[model samples]
Target chain A: MTRATLLTITAPTGTPAEGDAGFALADFDAPQVRITDLSVTRGDGVFETIAVIDGHPQALEPHLARLAHSAQLLDLPEPAAAVWREAVAAGVRDYRERNGEAGSGELFAKLIYTRGVEGSGRPSGWIFVDEGEDFSAQRRGIRVVTLDRGLRHDVAESAPWLLAGAKTLSYAVNRAAQREAVRRGADDVIFLSSDGYALEGPTSNVILLADGVVRTPQTDQGILAGTTQAAVFAFFEERGLATEYREITADELRDADALWLVSSVRMAAPVTDLDGREYPVDAELTAELNRYLLSRTE
Target chain B: MTRATLLTITAPTGTPAEGDAGFALADFDAPQVRITDLSVTRGDGVFETIAVIDGHPQALEPHLARLAHSAQLLDLPEPAAAVWREAVAAGVRDYRERNGEAGSGELFAKLIYTRGVEGSGRPSGWIFVDEGEDFSAQRRGIRVVTLDRGLRHDVAESAPWLLAGAKTLSYAVNRAAQREAVRRGADDVIFLSSDGYALEGPTSNVILLADGVVRTPQTDQGILAGTTQAAVFAFFEERGLATEYREITADELRDADALWLVSSVRMAAPVTDLDGREYPVDAELTAELNRYLLSRTE
Candidate 1:
């Protein structure tokens, strides 16, 4: 009989998981926390996906800044900066020990922060690390489907008090939307808010095209102002391309010269198809953005 | 120096927390689980609250029946009968161990059924033993505020793909609305669906009075049909009083004869004030309804 090896790490000291004294162990190969312990309460928490580059997290500072902003939106306690830095460092360490360096392909690090524990205040959180898909897919661009199954941006805009831009744990709906898209034989989905407004993609950022200008949803549209989205805007500005962040209707998407889904993993995957309509992939622009992202990380 | 004693519980098998693990524990005091471990992704859970009568959960059967109906709505795996028995047994056990038969006053019991673990394929769930509240405030009635927040009922109705009428985990907005209400010096809130239709209360059942008839928000409004509200309906029906479950407007609430909030904990808390407007408390009907609920529990 073969025995499986386990890797574990002690949960953060102040976390309620630490309250379970018996389950605490000292190791690093397996996760110390188990998924079953989660309850179905409001599931309010903040999370961020960091890129691991050359045994270190790329753009770590910006991710943390967004995480903090999201925590504030959710009314959750902000973990100490040192604690977040340490968690990210630990994840990077694990990645390096297990998979060597960033040259061995890109690693997607996910940091989850939640607070639903007994002693852990209502703002308890967790940080996790993960490796993203290889850049091979983005090398040839990707296909996408526009889905209208999620919340509308306007209603979400009206009720600004809720966790609008925050990366809360109430992500089951988002994940379900992605699953629906994948089920439809597409690589990803760009959610159209309930009112037929083009929102962001399920897990990635969104950018559209209209009348020779690059456009994306306004930040106030309840879409997460993604880090990669910001980088794209910056690149567009530096290159002197007219970048606009405004409300783009589904009708506008049909006439746009090009559309792309941007994220840390893919940098920018030009949309080849949307809602059964196909657009010519902008390979040259995609390569330029990917090169810019890689130049920063490398 | 005196030390404060902290009460905690751990799973019997010392299992680590699992994501999507919804139901399993029957006892809160046996050190089985933590509350925050529950998330909203599990659609197969239902809860009931009853006036603890003689150290026991009241209206256990009806509450169980409603829970079974809810589980069915979410396509839960457990049959109504089995889930009810487990809930009753757990409630009884919890009361016996935590509150004890010798105690007076009142207690509250909650039964939550969740789709346990990601792969169990069978819905996992549980019964929670907790404390109830004092009803002195209800006698005086309450001050409520009105707000139209998040997804309105019509949008939810159109988006039938989203879980409707299931006491699922997506309650962050609901709880936040309640918090906002309390912050504004109101005891509770009556949500106006996006279409300007009056909906239900956050934690309590809704009751509206107009034309000498007692009417509550329709179940089709996508509100969790309150078990206590149902009992009140039955009470009024037997007494030859007019009762209904239908669509109502906020304008209707202003002109209604009386509006009350119902729940297992508070029974029926009358709306004495709404949005700066005051209404006389209906003590006569409240007393009658209280008697009816007590009689049913007995």
Candidate 2:
């Protein structure tokens, strides 16, 4: 398998003037980030990961929009969307050409935009595409636990500095929650707002099915607006399953008819169990959703 | 007059047993970190910054202990204290050697320990020292503002995954809060817990003097145990003032007779104003305290 490909945006915050390439290919294995980059020093940055199926990057625009939204939340400069989009396309093309166009391996493109080296006003951006991990087992089913996120649901409005809705590089707590889930013998986690409402997972959005209606926790409660979740809802809508984005309490989540954690890289990971409570998986429907997700070209 | 000095720990998590050289000098201006380093991607790491004055690194042991403490909070493997300590010494030695030994610059050494490149399973460590910013004005006095931290004071106890107390690299919120302070036309910020208790500053600890007692927000409330704060307390105790660690509320902080934000690099910055309300600066006492802090050889 070919290793990952890397591209560094020469101008991350705006369009490149004439004569500026905007981006260039770089060595992926060698070090490319300065120790002083805010992304390394303070976790001061935004990022997006998009899944590529059959050489098509899924939900590219939504991912880019979210990346911009996250940057706005952090008060960072507006990202040069065209430059980043072109970089992703180039990264994918380079990877496919290297791996052979016939190889239809699932890949992921991670976009990183960081506050550059300390004391430098310039921001930094990078994009890299690599073969995705086998989430086959998780796609079919996975176990999860609920953990307290320790912030009130209204904090998003009450305290923007808390950076709740931003998909920032500062994900240590999310990583820790996932580790806590592993400690409890689970594969993932569903975080709860301190006010007793289900928030989102460390890296995924929570989707619940109840009374034939599908619902996911509202993003206004400081949770991310999942790119894959929108598609998941579309999938359900096509199947005549009503979908929603509303606040789902922890208790309501526990009582749901079914549940899944959705994200770009993993698509739809059905939660087979949550907090020791078992939930049956809809194998056929889940497979169809996966097929539908992989079939998307946008 | 010189740029920063850097030392990369060859082995970050253990004793450099059997002549491993433990650490080596690295080019400071070069890119020494990979984009995949968790410190860059996930902010999955811990760090410490210790002040050095006239060749002596202040509170060396306390800084090391706190680094280890922060690491444990993140479930990261125990850091190699001996190796780290030696690296700090080498860094200081290198700086003093290059610059004149008689040059008494206020330098700060930053220790960064991160979960290494993805899937490498190895940790990374580095130490860099540079002349501190000209905080002479801030040391004299500075304006401040209050922002909500969004997490209740008890979350550190109720929710370990929130990672309140750890000195992790996940500082996006802190950076955002600092920017918010700037937007509010203030020099810095003091974050209050959602439940209306004074927490700490984004980068410094809050020390309040009230009713003849010197107080600070308790560390149990998910605040870092400030190495410089301990010295501040000692400064107070020596002058026949009672020092305390208690849950100071927002109103109590406002009512305090005097206040200062203390940290390693900045030393002590007396808050001249809070939310536009003026507070008298004790210039004489502040200078003496800073003098005592700088003169320390331990």
Candidate 3:
């Protein structure tokens, strides 16, 4: 295993593998995909990133469910959850066993399933487990800016063809928005719909704290349902605070007492400033949330 | 070469190659891209497809210029046009030589330039020349349906981060619209902006003729500036017809005397029916236009 452990899904769908793990480990550093793969040529694919803490993949079931939902949205064949589940476990175990003490801390397993090479009528999938970037600075706090997502919040229901909420690989616009955020002297971005409603970030969900209650933009509004956000809500509920999901206006988001962008790998990163407005970061509470997030075994 | 000729651009940019074509012939069957390449993972890339007819690549310079323009929109390093131009020629020649008499008809050279493997500053470039699908039935006529693009027409100017006109690999939305069209009993689609303005098709440009004037939706409205549409205008201009570029409403498009979906591979595909309404197919005129389009030498 050269730094990372990679596996190509031999049986992405159909009956689960009994003796086998439904995948075959392959070279991680060598070229592994054809130039004509739809994922590369047309961005026709779905993906998920699962954070592995001490050989345990956090939110594994939710991530797999979202992957199936996204595949259905793209008209792709539903991936076999059992196969992917086993593949993720095998990938994490392989990476940990090969890296000795180096990989015991934090790692991410990325699962990519795509419409295969053109005209082949077959799908392709793979899982790669490797160390993730250090989010220490961003995990503490980061500056944020609001950018237009260029689609109405209702597009998910009105025009499903836009693939608003799917975790597809066609993320060029989302990547561009982050670049724009950097250009504007901010470290992150929260996208606002064309109809003037707060959505999610490029890769995370937005959460707000106000008036002793916690709120997040609903998943129906052309935004992804974050896996880490579920855990965050569980944290707040355990602390006796109320949590809700609804359509949030930009003005309401601005008036929140505290805010954070939560995702699978980075967990929770408190927002220190949104646009030009400053907010007080709840350092102690955020630290506790991250600590709880890292301690999840299943 | 195996059904196609593939070339890897070893030096995609910088000083142009003198002794070499700036590319190397590669195996078309082998996997050529890493799993982490941004093109596969994030759809962070731009591409262009040029038509090749009997050893001649039509509108090569214009296609290269558009490719450069799209790269600029994505903030990618400008591709050395001279290097790509030579690569296309080599790829076409190689394909023809390998296929002999079988490749005398129509071929396409697809130029793909991507933000290379993750964490590596180097970009990736490749060209593949292959025979296109037979378009005899589609050339006669295609049934089209209007679908919402879910973006305002002015997003190209107002929200550059949307990457509306850049022709990036993030084309899943466009692909989904075509699938939706098929579901609606149509063979193709013409996307309408959220503001009710006529826009381009999923893989082609929409051209309309009415009252002796040839018109197309202006490219500034978040639509690709079409290379084939330019040649279509030239065909009409030679026959003493005026051509115009302006924002066209959906009603105007529906009432046109004639319409076509022009593209690189298919050239000119006449539209006979739109949204259950019928238009008389001008087979002779469409055939003449395609002949002229195929006759371009440069």
Evaluate candidate 2 by giving its C-alpha RMSD to the native, one decimal.
Answer: 1.3
| Candidate 3 ranges beyond 4 A from true positions | A16-20, B16-20
Q: What local lDDT score does residue A154 receive in model 1, on the 0 to 100 scale? A: 69
Q: Per-candidate TM vs. native?
A: 0.79, 0.98, 0.98
**TM-score of model number 1, chain B:** 0.79
Residue B38, model 1, lDDT:
27
Q: How many Å off is the CA of B294 in candidate 1?
A: 4.2
Q: Given candidate 2, what's the lDDT at residue A262?
A: 93
Best of the candidates, lDDT: 3
* Model 1 residue B265 CA deviation in Å: 3.3
Better of 1 and 3 by lDDT: 3
Give DockQ: model 3: 0.89
Write out the backbone clash pairs for model 3: none
Cα deviation at B29, candidate 1, in Å, is 7.2
Q: DockQ, in order, for the candidates?
A: 0.21, 0.91, 0.89
lDDT of each: 0.62, 0.92, 0.92
Task: List, residue by residue over B51-83, the lDDT tens digit for candidate 3.
Answer: 999989989998999989988888889999888
CAPRI tier for the interface of model 1: incorrect
